[model samples]
Target: MTAARDDHTRWEELAAGYALSALEPADEEAFLGHLPGCEVCAELIADAREVMAGLASTAPAVEPPASLRDAIVAAATPRAGLPPSPRQPRRRETRRSRYAAVAVVAAVVLIVVLGVWNVALQLQDRGQEHRLAAAERVMACVEQPGCRAIPLAAAKGGQVPVTALVRGREVSLVADGLPPNDTTGTTYVLWQKTGAADPSPVAAFDVTRDGVAVIDAGRLTDPLGTTEWLAVSHETGREPPAAPSEPVALGTVS
Candidate 1:
C-alpha cells in the first residue's frame, strides 16, 4: 500500500512533464515502467500526450543541425572521475556515468512540439541540462545501422514517418505527425506481421493532437527477421487486439 501511495504522489508531481519528456532519464524510465498497470497514470499520459499533439501544430519546422549527432555522442561519452587537486578544498559530490545518458530518446520529428519544448525550457531555466539531452541522444542513435525511417500511411487518413530500431525481439519506435484518437472505447494499436501469418499486436497507444509519440519499445520485441510489415489499427480497448480487424495505417519494415 505504501508503494502504491508513493506511485500516486510521484504521478501527481511529474506525470505530465514525464509525458512531455521533461524528466531525467532515470525518472522517465521509472515512469514508463509504472505506466502499464497504473490506469490512473495511463489516463494522465493520454491527456499529456494530447497536449503534446496540440503544441506540435504550432511549433516551427527545422532540420536538426548536422552537428547535433556529434554533439549528442560527445555528450554521452564517458569521462574519468578525477580527484580535486591537493591545493583545493574538497567537497562531496554525487555523479552518474555517461553511458547512462545515451539510453535513447526514441522518436523522429521535424517539428518539435512547443509544449514539450517549453517544459524542457523550464527545466533548463532551473539548470537541468542533462535531462533534456536524453531526447537528443536518442535522436542521434536513430542514425545508427539497424534503425531506419519510413512513412506510416493510409489511403484515406493522415500519416506519419516512423523511426524504428529493432534489437533481437525488442524495438524502439518513434513517430512524427502522430495524432491521438478521441473516439470512445477505441484506441490505436501496433501490429507486426510475419510472412503469411496474421499480424500480432506488438504495441498499443493513443494520440490527441499532431506530434511525435514513442510507442512502448518493450512491446516491439518479435523474432527479428521474421517480422515483416508494421501496421496501426483502431480497436476496442483489448491490446494486440485478437486482430487489428481494421488497420488505420500500414508500412513495410525496412
Candidate 2:
C-alpha cells in the first residue's frame, strides 16, 4: 500500500495508538510505512510498544462477545447509517427462556471474573517469589558459620530496632519504625571501620516508610570478621561518599 505523507504533528498523534495495536487497519498500515523513514517516530513508537507489552502482564485478560464491541461502536457513532438489526432468537416459553438467558449471562460474567482473579494471583505470586529470594539471603547468612547479627541503633536519637545479618561479605539489614522521607536525593550508606583505621564506605541503599531495607552491600573489601564497627548514615545519593561521616546508626561488627 502506498503511504500518505502526513505532517509531523499528525504522525506523532497517531504513533501511540498504532504502537498499542489499537489503531484501525488503514492507519496502522500507513503509520508503519511512515515509521521506517522517520527516526523520531520510530523511537517513540518502539517505546510505546514496550510499555504496552509490559502493561499486558499486569492487566486482566478477558475476551467478551463480539456483540459487546458492536454495541460500543453503535453507541458512539451516528445512528443514521447503521444497517438493519438481525432478528434475535424468540422462544415460545418466554419466561423460561429469559431465565435460561440470565443464567448464561451470569456464568459468562463469573468466568471472566475468575480469569482476571487468576491473573492477579499469578502476578502477586511472582512478586512474593522475589521477596522470598531476598529473605532467603538473610536466612542463609544467619544460618552460615561466622554470621553476625549486628544491632543498628541510632546514635543521637530514640532508635528503632535494626539488625544487620552478615556472612562473609553478604549483608542484609532489616529495620523497623523508619521515618518517611523523600528518598529522591538521599540514601543509606553503610560504613565499615576496622579497629582505629579510617571508616570505609561500603554499599548504599534506600528504605520505604515502613523501614524495610534489604541491601546487598556486595562483598566487603576487607574479610567479614575483620571489621570492628558497622554503621549506616543517611546521606545525599547519586554516589556513596569516600569516608565515614557521622553515623545515623552504629553497632559493633563481630
Candidate 3:
C-alpha cells in the first residue's frame, strides 16, 4: 500500500509537469504512456487542456509576413539546373570544377538562410500566442453570456489586480498578480467545488512572472447544482489528487 501511494504521488507530480509543458521529451512520452490507465492523471490532463484552450483563444491572430512566405516558396522551388554534384570532364575541366564548388557553396548558404527564417517564424508565433492570451482575458467578460466580473486584489505589496469572469457554463479566470513560475518541476492546478460531495477539476496552468493566466471552467457537474468555490494548488506530476489545497477565490453561478 505504501509503495502504491508513493507511485501515485510520483505520477501526480509528472502530471503537473506535463500540464505545464515543462516535461522533457522522454518524461512526456512516459507520462503519455501511463495516461491511458490512470483516471486521476487523465482528469488532470483534461483540466490542463481547458486552460490551454483558454490561452489559445486569447492569443492574438497574426498573419505571416509577405517576405517570409515568398522566401519559403522560393526555397521550396526546384532550380532548373544541374544538381550540385561532380560534373564529368568537359573542354574546360578546371573552370567547370570551380563553378561546381561555387554552386555547392550557394546551396549551403541557402540552407542556412532557410533555417534562420524558420526560427524567426517560430518566434513570431510565440509572440502572437502571448498577445492573444492577454487579449482573451480582456475580452472574456464581453464574449461569454452570464459572465460577471470580479476584481481580485493582490495579497500584499502587489501592484496588479486580477479580473475574473463567471459566464454561462464556465468561468474565465485571468490574473496578473501571481509570481512567475521558475521552478524546474512545479505547476498550478485549479479546482472548483459546489460545497457538495467533491471538488471538480477546472484547469492546470503555468503561471508567468506577471502571474497572468486565463483559466477556463467548462460546464461542471455537481450534486448540489451549484458552482461556488475555486482554488489553486502547486504540485508536481502529470496528475494531482482529487482535492485542492485550499480555496483561493469563491463565487457563485447566477
Candidate 4:
C-alpha cells in the first residue's frame, strides 16, 4: 500500500496502539518509522508505551490451558479446499484484556496501601496525645498538697512565664507563656528557699521557645508543715548555681 504523507494524523492516532504492540506488525513498523522525526507522534507513542508497560507489570500471567492450545491449532490448520480455518480463537491473549485486568488490580492495591498508612499515622498521633494528658494529670495531683503557684513573668521583653507548685518536700514547676530558651547554651533552673538558710538548687530543665517544662520538686510528704519557696532561674549547663541572681516568681507552700 502506498504510504501517504498526508495520513500523518491518522498514523499519529494509531501510534499509541502501535507502541503498545496492539497493532498488527505492518502498522507497528509504519508508526515506528514515522515517530523519530515527528515530535507529536513521538509523544503519542511514549504515552501509549507507558500505559502498556504499567499493564504488563501489573497483569497476572495466565498460562493457556493445553486443551485450548490444541483446539486453537486444530481450528487454524488449513483443510484441503476449505477456507483457511477461521482465525482460531486467540489462545495467547490480547493486550486489551491484559490491561483491563491490570487496571483493576492496580486500583485495589493502591487503595489498600493508602488505607493502611493513614490508619497507622492516626494511631501514632493518638498515642502521643494520651501520654501528654497523663503527664498533666500527675501534675494536678502534686499541686493538691497545699503547693503554692509562683508566676515567673517574662524578663527583658520575653513572653515566657513560669508557675511553681511548691509542697513540703516536693515542688513541681510548670512553665507556660515563656519564650523557649536558647538550646545552644541555656537551660531553666528551679530553686528552693530554706527560709533563714540560703537558697538550694532543686532541678534544671530545658524549655523550647514555646511549650511547657515540668520539673520534679523533690518529695514533700508534709503538706501543712514548714515553709518552702520555689523559683525559676535561667542558666547554661548541667549544674545550676545554688543561689539564683534573680527569681522570675516566688510562692510559699503552706
Q: Pick the candidate with the highest TM-score.
A: 2
Off by over 4 Å in 1: 1-138, 155-161
* lDDT top scorer: 2
TM-score of each: 0.41, 0.44, 0.38, 0.39
lDDT per model, in order? Answer: 0.54, 0.61, 0.54, 0.53
Q: Which 10-residue span in candidate 4 carries the lowest summed lDDT?
A: 64-73
Taking the tens digit of each residue's C-alpha lDDT, what string does model 3 give over 106-194? 34334545566678789777756765886676676667665567554443435544455655455556765565554566666656677
Residue 209, candidate 2: C-alpha displacement in angstroms: 10
Off by over 4 Å in 2: 1-82, 85-127, 151-163, 169-184, 206-213, 223-226, 242-248
Off by over 4 Å in 3: 1-136, 139-144, 151-162, 182-184, 208-211, 215-219, 222-225, 247-254
What's the lDDT for candidate 3?
0.54
What local lDDT does model 3 show for residue 98?
Answer: 30
| Candidate 1 colliding pairs | 105-138, 169-221, 169-222, 170-221, 180-207, 180-208
Clashes, model 2: 0
What lDDT, from 0 to 1, does candidate 4 have? Answer: 0.53
The local lDDT score (0 to 100) that residue 111 gets in candidate 3 is: 52
